[model samples]
Target chain A: MTAAAGTARAVWRRPPLIRNPRLRWAIYGGSLVYLVLAFASVDVNWTRVYEGLDRGLRFVEGFLVPDFVSRWGDIAQGMQESLTMTVTATVVGIMVSVPIGIGAARNIAPLPIYLACRGIIALSRSFQEIIIAILFVAMFGFGPFAGFLTLSFATIGFLAKLLAEDIEDIDEAQAEAIRSTGAGWWQVVNYGIQPQVMPRLIGLSLYRLDINFRESSVIGIVGAGGIGATLNTAMDRYEYDSAAAILILIIVIVMLAEYGSSIIRQRVQ
Target chain B: MLRLQNLTKTYRTGDRALNGVSLTVEPGQVVGLIGPSGAGKSTLIRCINRLVEPSSGQVTLGDTALTGLGHGSLRRARRRIGMIFQEYALVERLTVMENVLSGRLGYVGFWRSFFRKFPPDAVSKAYALLDRVGLSDHVDKRADALSGGQRQRVGIARALAQDPDLLLVDEPTASLDPKTSRQIMRLIVEICDERGLPAIINIHDVALAQSFVRRIIGLKSGEVVFDGAPNELTDAVLTRIYGEEDWSATIRPVDEESDDQVDDPDAEAEHHGPAEVLDRERMAGLS
Candidate 1:
């Protein structure tokens, strides 16, 4: 036992997980205190949870045999609307983002233009897509058009920020060479900036298209038009099987989109 | 004719890259600029086309004052001046043909170039330039797919496509093997001679510069240390430019005329170690 204790003592003399023992102790003590406080402040309604157990089981049971056929018309129309919104929003968003992205890159654009484009990106990114959809629905009277506008604005923010960062990271020497050829600003962008970002741009656009589709379903809960509206209505009417069917459809479509995007990205890269 | 008066550049970081340098080059005259690293060779070459904006200077190419020209006019003036970079600087993603055609960006409009719908004459000229640079077979190949020498050829072709009055070559052979460097230098000097286009080649190898250029300008600490005929770039002048080096030991032999100096058995015997070190250093620097 003394031999074993000596070996253990030698091991303990070595460095702890953190180099500083005091800091390590402080982190451990602080986490333990926080965990205790969190456990102490717990609140629960056991009776209510017990009462809802059967309802939760019934909701889970509906997934075993989803009624996809009874609500086929609603599901199909909602999916079509979602698809349209996704396509339109992604296309318009990409088109608008390209110029704004170029303008936002500090290496390329002048200061004022860079600042303004960045301001637009920040403003759009600051709000949630559903929030934007809500505001647009109030303005445009609730439809896929409002959803389209909301997703388009969100896509612009996402795409432009990534595109600007990609532009900024490209080889400045290549652009300098173009500029030295007496090329104008537009010509420099065409020959210099565009080629470097093309593959990434293609990949990002496809990814954004996938995202806009997912967001399209969410926006419909606010009556902005899509599969979410149908899913919400079915759930409100206690048609859990129909709601399950809608969710399965969303999952399948999202999976297909993800697979498609990966294939396209591989080809481009 | 090209002229520079008191060209100076003090960068934002307070590094004075070029200090009140002045020089002139007549039409069709090929001059080599020799200097150590950070000796303002690049700054001088870039300053000619106003790529590195001079804090205070006057750059007159023929009749136009290049230093004071606005964006549009500066670009127009830049069209007449072609620059070759050390790293080739060809757009890697573009094809050789497209990269070469981009040189004519000054002449063509945005939509035309964007669609790759260059005029027939421009296309033919680009082909001719490619043929001259000996890359006619690789026109469809992407720029990044090319070897170093081939890329430099594409760079040269692109520069030539601009139809520039003056060519500014910055360390054109820095990244090339010694033999490849010689070939590239030969090609550049030959092209310049054929077209009667005046050029300024910034080179590191003094031996190469001695072989190619009739006139040499040596810069040290951003100032002109020596300016004379290539024959005048002796061991003493090199010492003045590069500082504290045994010139006779490190200096590489030039052409047949310098055979006597190179054939010195005793000097070669004494400097063999330092020569190897210099060669290793040079190779390391090149890589």
Candidate 2:
């Protein structure tokens, strides 16, 4: 009985994942060496950084004494344009994406349709919003029209790809049950697929709206039109206080949008 | 009448799920299909509805040949064939009334169904079916909110909403407790009897199948091995159907269903090990 108790109390240790010690050590040593080499290649301009400290301090002080009263007209107009672009672009992009997203889902659509939809998504996603904004600005001249097109295009790629993946990953058994009922293709999609992905689709659209608003502020730096245009003009004129006020307004709007979207998302879920 | 002549299904992965299987069901007949896991019971049922397209076979219901129909015809054909699933595959997000009404999707137009607007006839029938299933109070409840037996009852209501001539019931009670399982089986059999609707129930439990079904068809590795009345399922016959096991305890007389006392711990132990009981008795006698 004593021996049996001793046997039951046998010690256990977790097995090692990497069986080859040399290979493991070699990989660790190689990563450390590469990291050190990568870090050493960086160049820093200490004198330039020191010289810019006073300018940075002025920028920081501008926030303390914001010139919102002077540039209130410009700020309000820019906010309106940004909000308009965000709303229209989001609505239009969502409308276009719904069909494309359905087509791209492997389980739902035919092989050819899936391929074409995926290709379109890939093309839209490859270019950054700033790059697309630059192209559209060149094509249509500098204004919110260019910004709208860019944001709408970017929204398509983001919304459609995620929506397609969600559709692909849906409960097959639910869809199968619907299909077994002799539901037509449209009927199956309306009942089986829509209900499953509605919440996610709403959540994603809200997220994209938030994203497009932030992006509208940015693309304006390239003269695509928004608050970023006003911000750029202030920067050019060295009106740091006005620039700070515009930045603060942009931040406040984005925060409100995010909070509102989150609340709405919670309600839907 | 429904007939499947030379029905076969070979999946994309080259797995022969069903091979040259054929069977027929007369009007108002309740057939129980018994098989081990992966023995093509599911594939066979799915083929009849053309949900899993049969590689080579003919599925005939009444005078219509179901296999070669175009998209429009197929949808119309599917409306007449009701199916009940094991997991009670109710759309979790939809309400019970909506789920039940989804059965009439093939019959209704796209716009009508989409707006949650069924014809008054369909709406009244849905309400009646819900009441019949003892879920009149829960019509507005989301399908995900129901218990196992209740969810299955809703599934039955949905299938009945189609007013299907033929019913394909796949493992209707697989995920339920023993009593719930029995209740579901009894309900299905009673419903079939009442409406004179033919049904094919793919079941796992041999005894449960024996207890409820009028006729049995045993599938062994994608082929039919036994098709006969429940009483003809002797020990050797069961051995032929389900490889081999000490099936004495598994088999029971149909009238012995009053033996819910079988759930008693004493009876369970006795059924499990007769040798142990005999040895204990012998030891007691010697002592």
Candidate 3:
């Protein structure tokens, strides 16, 4: 017994094994492995990079004049179409999403309805805007309508999910008190649910509108009507200067939408 | 008048919140329910309104059987039975006047309520209730801005706005200080007396309940352990209700006047003759 006690004491006195190593070594090892694989797999020819840089410099030098003087009419038309599609999609998406988002919130809706709405949102979010635009273009024969539909689905996915989360986090005490007044389900939703979620919903919708504007420029590449259709055609014909001008215009529009949406969001919040 | 006959509520997890509890409240009588935490006091009050539905029971308010009713009928029945919560349960974002007017939502149409077009009588009654609750000047203030005592006053006004025949208050003073608790209890008693409304109040403060209510119902572990007049509530009864003998030390009468004089700016400012008389009346009602 004395021998066993001494052994137990010695065991207790011994220092424990350190369980964790410094995570920085793991990061360094991963980076070294990635560098080794990259260097081993890639055919890094310096001559090709130099030639590409020269071509890029020549392209930039050619676009010094911007070429807007001749293509102003087409550029203006494309800008208008893009703006129209963005606004229409955002408004319609917001209108549809309010109900769908409320229905998807588990706290607000029944189990089956919440699950179905969540599934719909998941399906809408799974596809990229370009892929959705391609499908709509094939079905609706390639027009601004197709782009509008694609952006609407995308907007519903993002905005509705955010709005549902906001609804779910609302103060349930207010809802309970309202229900205690013998108010119907609709009345509870209108008075209790709407006031809490409205401000957040407005802010999210404005942010989604800005995102939809940027997406609208690209969806047109899939034969959906917007500035991207013109951009793609210019690129196909090797009109690099015209395509560069269109790219600059698209950037300007996106910047303006971002600023406008920021102001609206600040006001709402 | 309200009566709960053999009411019991067993949750899905098989925990019995209320087990075969029965009680009665006569018109214009304020009965106080006292119990330790998890003794089913809140459950008893909630079951009266069917807010938390009882597993099995008959809760009858006058002529209507509150239990086993359809959803629509239950809702309509709930309008006549006003309930006050421990946390006030006012919609914090809404104005005090709007919170008071919410009491009449049962009678208003959905479209009218959505547009905030309450009837003229409802608006005037809400204004009167605000005045009665001493919140007339704060009608437009948000409910979240009110202090605990003021919020409970708003809660009382909101329940009174329902023109209820039965008032069920669950821990209305639980979150308040002793002074504020006394004031809230006084207000409850005064309102019930003035309107001839029957009420059942649940509280953890045995002394406060004994002072304010004529009848006391003590609960323990989901059962009614003691039911008698407040005068008959002895230390032994408290021990039986709480499952301990050490709570007698905590049941002494509190110095409410000094506490009120220190914290309440309004009470301090109104320290003149009529206010002192009013305070005495409040104290008498509380005791």
Candidate 4:
């Protein structure tokens, strides 16, 4: 071929993630075939889908015209239990998380303490809150106490893991400056790392407070106690309106929590 | 005197940053160290405080051997040494006064420092140092709000607040403008003279180091290639330390000319963080 024709025919494209062209094309083709096979395997019954849609429309209607008066007593009691569990669990979780978070931060902690604390955080995070709630409910015989424990345990995983990551990412130069002054370990953390991470930690704690409140509502349905238990009872009786009322209350409270937390977070920053 | 006898450091990655380098700095002597990047200047300075821990060697400050100290005593010995960083590593969220007072954390108890209640002398000393560095009015301002030169001034105040015997300054002016760089160098050297304190300042700017410091030590590939008075740093010596490169522009007689007008407050307030150091090279060349 002439030089101009050869040059015109040549083309360049960005490199593929998998360097081997055959392997990359094969991978793409395999995923497309797998998607087709998976969809083919799915058994969707149109009859059941239509029934579920009809039932869902009733749910929407119940939500639109919620019955507040009939379920007001149970709703009030359940909300009170939920708020109490959320606040106490958050306070206790934060109190416990500070030490564990410090231990888990590799930059600050020794290897043994770091490993142990990381293991605790990983274990707490592995299982979903609902699973923990079920386990706690079984162990404690179905009460708000079990719900409280589940929420607190879940909070530890969430708060401590985030706090540890924040600590690890702090400015080493600032820490070095502090250490050069001959400060003790506690003093180094206070003078150097704490100031850098405090604003974020405060924001996280506020965020976690709302998360615990939300989770408390969920853990209650598994024989633990809160608004979810009230919700479960109403749902079992086919009292959609009462269930809608409980859901509305939970949403309103959660929105308020989110709004309040954001304001506080903005101020702290 | 601060002494490093055969100080060596080989990173875990098998990179030998410093190789059997040794030096002594006498009391009240200010030594400026110059080298190419990765030539072990930072490692040498950190080794004295055992901050970067010399892989195999000894660092002794006065009667105590720093390398052998346990946690408690290492801290005790460390309190006597002050460190200044290239980035002016102030606790950004803290008030300037708090950053300065943090230098006395070693002397005060945990609760006392935790509550920010320093010893009366340390507090007064911090105030005096802040005044000396011309940051007296900005003490209550957060460190992050100040200019780079101002933050470095706080770094100096913090170092002095320790009542330290020796100061290990790592690239003190690497992040500053030419004018501000000169100011900080003058301030550091002046303070060293006033306190009769020994210091090892690792500076990369050949001309700037030559202008301010009396003694100079050059490092090349982890060894001391040149150690002499600044005036003795000729073209051949520059080539030896930094490898063969045009040295005429870098090693001329000190300009001794009037500096450019002071930078505006807004310009000063802009961050001269490490990321901005590249832009400064052209400015350094012009100056």
Candidate 5:
């Protein structure tokens, strides 16, 4: 009886099993299945990968001595064009999106207008900027104008949707209280909606400007006129070193634009 | 100066929030509407401002028939009436000064109000009102930063800045502690008396209403059960208003006895496992 009592006491004193065994077993089985599938699907061989790595290293070594001395003029011109396209498109996009976004916000605008604006934004957002650029290239016949239009449409879709959401999430009581004070609809929007949304809109616009800069570089690949056009030409000619140089310049330009816009966004907000 | 005749409101859910309610408030009188929850006190107050449009009624403010006016005209008429809310309802992101200045928005242009460029007189009045509410040092603080009582003070300051002839307050003390509730009631009563502006307040506490208001309007199931001076608010009248004797029985003993009787140590020991029981018991003791 004494031994039985001691055993019972020891069993009772043990902590409860808080961790579920079924969940642990399921996770273990899932990982095992994933590993088996990954290994089965891969055609990876150590010898081929090792040989490919050497060739890549040798090709990169050739570009280590960048020959920017002869190509400086071309590089500067391309950079200028890229910066202008990005800035112009972003500015125009933000300027146009303010009204469109306000109209799309159902809390602010009438139902019909909100639906129409939302549909436009949706259409613009559904396609990639390159696809839109291709369409513009067809209509306007291949230039920076095509790229600008594409970027503007894409930015409007993204920025307007974000701005509309910001407007919707504002303190509604402020608007109601302003209305109660006999303020007109315009007055209520101006006082109640504008203050709350302005900072967020500015932040979103700056962030989009940075994204547009990156997108502008690639949109030029379809004869839209930027560094991307030159980069494509270099790649087609098998001038890998020149392609590497252009890639480096594009990275630098994007980084600079991102830094500048981030500073402005912080200050404004 | 404000009158409601046969005011009625029925929701789409088939709930009659206010059923044929009518009352009148003369200038300079503080009228208190007392009722249990869902007794249409809030609906009646909101209907006065046409915030909740009465289904069918005659609502007159001064010489104007409020119920008959068009939206634009009604909006213009609303400027003369100031409203204070239970949650304070000052825009949380805005500074105390800006929230107070918002009361003058009706008189200012859209561009001016947008930029927060209130008239010099309005700005001065906002400062004075803030000072009156003892929130002078907190003029720059955001509305969300302030405590419940301080936010209510800001609400009063905002309403007063409107220079209104009539004030509508809805459950101004419902969210406050007993001490803060009395303070807010005192401020409302003092403001109404000093400005000679008639005010209507919706309140749940009968004792608070009786202590602060000159006239008490009692509502039961969305209809007025009693309307008279605070002195006429008796146990029999309360029973009719609440439709139960439980509240009177609970309240009368507390009112009669100056001290709480539920402070027995043995009873308190039984409430040791959860503090919620003790907290509720303490609240019941206060009431």
Candidate 6:
């Protein structure tokens, strides 16, 4: 076989990659079986799906002819609550997370502090914002304060994790240069870590602010106070038009938040 | 005066980077450390500033004992010892002025520096240093935007900003072109001279080191094998330090012919014959 291949190489030759037909076939077959099992487990009810489609068409209609005039007062108040909660939570969360993030970064922090910060980040991130809001509402007796705390926790989890990762990836040589100058630990962070991660942190904070605003609207479902409560009430009373108005306002605000943050992110970068 | 006594460093991986090395530097003296890669040149420089902590030994800068000092005092001692890196370790996102001002981080409080409110005197000194480094107009430019040579200039200015008593330079010209390497070495020597600051420059190019430094210290296998003036760094001494490779090629000046061209056009125009013959004989003996 060697002599034949050597003699025939000038005509044509296959590259040295060996094909594995059995493994390829097994992968294809396994994917097909998993697809079938996933569909089987869905348990989608066709009759309910038809009813949902009908309801969805009605929702779309209501969305177009939203009852903005009648529920304007409630909608305006709820929006104000969400806006205040988002801003307050985001600012406080950022203030808290900067140090925590620094502590969490393995490259910068001591081992014990790094572990503790990691634990805090994990705990905050473990529960959904709604679950945390329910807990806070139960403890604090239902208000925008609960929503504020919930969003702040969520913000800390997200911002700290991302910022810490960014800090870990920064150029260590620059940090060493700072340290060699006899700068203290905080001085090293302020000069070394902060400059490298500032643009990313600002971008992340803006993004977290947008996220907290969205989450604030939803946390009101657990009596934490925002547009979600108004939305729930309008839905229960079958005031679809008023519900549509609240949703429209939320969509508009989120869109504005997204647009503004992107502009700021571009400038920062 | 700066002194390193019985300095030794063994990494966690058990690689002995520096082994019982001892040295001293007098004020305003520029000492060149030359060795093959991994012969502990960088480890020795870092040991001086305690950037890479020595496993055992004492590093005395003036009256302070740098070894075994706690975090706070180590930082205080580090402030007086300036360090330059091969990569020109400037914070890339910061402006040239900010990077230079960072040398005063040890002097300023966190709040004051955080708000970028360095003392007016520090600011003026940073400006003067930038001008001295010939980067006055590029003060507001970000460090990453500068050329390699320009960035290294900023690195030198930042080190000088500390008003350090001693400078620790690690492979200062390792990443530069021949012309740029000479320029950087010249700048370091001039600055060290003017400030009366002693400097230890870890260098790769032996000829450049000979041109700049007053004394040369050659290390082999984490030990100082040769310590004397540049004139004493003969081909045989280089072979002793770097081992049985092409020492003649390594020691022969790469571009000193250009230096003579710039000064005297006819001094050594026809003097390459004897040097070439000696180099060939050395190559034959080594083989």
Question: Which candidate gets the maximum TM-score versus the true structure?
Answer: 2
lDDT of 3 by residue, B106-175 (tens): 9999999988899999999999999998998899998889999999899898888888998888778767
Query: What TM-score, to 2 decimals, does candidate 6 have?
Result: 0.88
lDDT of 6 at A155: 89
Ranked candidates, highest lDDT first: 1, 2, 4, 6, 3, 5
Give the true-structure RMSD of model 4: 5.4
DockQ of 2: 0.38
Q: Can you tell me the DockQ of model 5?
A: 0.31
lDDT of 5 by residue, B1-287 (tens): 99999998776556787788888899899999987677777778778777666778888999999998998888878888899886677777778998888888788887888777888999999999999999999999988899999999999988888888899998787777667877898999999999999999988777777667879899988899999987687778888887655443223242443323322223222211222322222122211
Q: Per-residue CA lDDT of candidate 1, range A1-269, in tens?
A: 86877754444465567988799899999999999999988988899999899888888889888999999999999999999999999999999999999999987788999999999999989999989999999999878999999999999999999999999888766888898999999999989888999999999999999999999999999989989788889989999999999999999999999999999999975
Over B1-287, each residue of candidate 6 has an lDDT whose tens digit, in order, gives: 99989998787657787899999999788999987777777778877777777889889988888888887888888889888888799999999999999999999888898899999999999999999999999999999999889999999999988989999997777667666777888899998888899999988677677777879999987899999988687778988887765555445353454442222223212112222322222122211
Consecutive 10-residue window with the lowest summed lDDT within model 5 chain B: B266-275
- Please give the distance, in angstroms, between residue A78's alpha carbon in candidate 2 and its true position after superposition: 0.5
Which regions of candidate 3 fall more than 4 Å away from where they truly are? A1-48, A58-67, A237-244, B253-287
TM-score of each: 0.89, 0.93, 0.84, 0.92, 0.79, 0.88
Per-residue lDDT tens digits of candidate 4, residues A108-198? 8989999999999999999999999999988998879999999899889999999999998887778878888999989989989999999
In order of DockQ, best first, we have: 4, 1, 2, 3, 6, 5
Which candidate number has the best DockQ?
Answer: 4
Which tens-of-lDDT digit does each residue in A1-269 have in candidate 5?
86877754434454535367787788889999999999999998989999999868856874785555556676677767777888899999999898899999987798899999999899989999899989999999877888889899999999999998888887665676666777788887776777678778878887887888788778889978777777777767766677778888778767886788788877765
Candidate 4: clashing pairs of residues: none
lDDT of 1 by residue, B56-156 (tens): 98999999999989989999999999988888889999999999998999999989988999999999999999999999999999999999999999999
* Clashing pairs for predicted structure model 1, backbone only: none
- Residue A93, candidate 5: how far off, in angstroms? 1.7
Candidate 6 residue spans exceeding 4 A from truth:
A1-28, B234-236, B253-287
For lDDT, candidate 1 versus 3, the one ahead is 1
How big is the positional error of residue A52 in model 5, measured in Å on the Cα after superposition? Answer: 7.7
The segments of candidate 5 whose C-alpha lies over 4 angstroms from its true place after superposition are: A1-70, A249-269, B13-15, B231-287
Residues A1-269, candidate 3: write the lDDT tens digits.
Answer: 86877754444454535434566567778899999999899888899999899878866865784666566787777778888999999999998888889889987798899999999899999999999999999999887899999999999999889999998788766777787888888888887778778778888888887888788889888899888787777777767788788888888877887888788877754
When only the first chain is scored, the TM-scores of the models are: 0.89, 0.96, 0.84, 0.93, 0.81, 0.91
- Give per-residue CA lDDT, model 6, range A190-265, as digits (tens): 8888889999999999999888888988999889998887787788888889999999889998999999999999
